[model samples]
Target chain A: DVKVTQSSRYLVKRTGEKVFLECVQDMDHENMFWYRQDPGLGLRLIYFSYDVKMKEKGDIPEGYSVSREKKERFSLILESASTNQTSMYLCASSTPGETQYFGPGTRLLVL
Target chain B: AQRVTQPEKLLSVFKGAPVELKCNYSYSGSPELFWYVQYSRQRLQLLLRHISRESIKGFTADLNKGETSFHLKKPFAQEEDSAMYYCALSGLGGATNKLIFGTGTLLAVQP
Candidate 1:
């Protein structure tokens, strides 16, 4: 089975503090994605990486960034955590033309 | 720009009732669509893909190009079927495989 693991299930951060959310996929998929899931807005893409050292901006990439130094690992970074950034963060990995496998998700609260 | 839209925020149905979750899309090219389900306390996972043409857990989705919609349907809803459903579209080319997702619908199957 494809397994995607997130670094944390819940996190609390102070305003202006930097936050890092990590995701690792054991399936060795080529594409990794970061998405923020809000109640009414659903899941909005933050950033995505098709390969190591390469990244692309998604619909809502303003306050977030992503890094993929290794094929199996992808990290989402918040330059400065804000109250508005508090939401559920989901990570996904998939092969080309295949279904994405998602992590359990991390709920972050910025105070 | 490519976009996916799920009109309903929530849908409630009693057990054994038929259920349908609507999904529409706006894309210029031929699109690949998918339905993903997230059960309570479980990771988001692929419920079905249009290309696969398979039913999962009594749920099936049919992609209608004329209407630009992919609606998930089930003949008999179960209490276990209560979950959040998302519709997604793949990027233009198969190489990137980036997905554009809808706002999502929360289905409540009451027993």
Candidate 2:
């Protein structure tokens, strides 16, 4: 089965700390995406990478950054964690226009 | 900008009841619509796509070009069918193939 694995299922961090959320896919898909999901606001894309070493900003890229140094790995970075950044973070991988396979989300809480 | 709208925040139904989760989109070009489901404590996964025209787990979706809607329907809801459903749309002319999602609907199947 195709699998998208997230580094953590739940995480807690302090304010002003740098947090890293890692995702790895076994499908070898070229497109990877990071999104934050909140109640009522839905899922908003933070960053997406179509290929290794290439990245693009999404609708809400304010306090988040992403790294895709390898095709199977994509990492979401919170430069400086804040309370408002506490939400469910999901990572997905896809092949071009096909359906995306998502990881078990990481629920982050900043204190 | 392309957008997706899922008007209902929650839809409650009993076993053997018909289910419909509404989804609408705004796009100038031909759009590809998808329905994603996240069961409790599980990864978000694709339930159906308009292009495939295949039903998974007894759920189906039809894309209406005139109405700009892609509503999910299941003739009989099961107790295990409770999940959060998200509607997503992808437009053709984008290089990154980004998806715009709507605020999800929580389907509660009561036994």
lDDT of 1 by residue, B1-107 (tens): 78899999999999999999999999988899999999999999999998889999999999899999999999999999999999999854587788888999999
Query: Could you tell me which residue pairs clash in candidate 1?
Result: none
lDDT of 2 by residue, B39-78 (tens): 9888888898898999999999999998999999999999
Clashing pairs in 2: none
TM-score (C-alpha) between model 2 and the true structure: 0.96
Per-chain TM-score (chain B), model 2: 0.95
- Which parts of model 2 are misplaced by more than 4 Å? B93-95
> What's the C-alpha lDDT at position A1 in model 2?
85
TM-scores for the candidates: 0.97, 0.96
Candidate 1: Cα lDDT at B19: 99
The Cα RMSD across the true interface for model 1 is 1.4
Candidate 2's iRMSD: 1.6
**Tens-digit per-residue lDDT, A12-81, candidate 1:** 9999999999999999899999999999898888999999999999889998888899999999999999
Runs in model 1 deviating more than 4 A are none
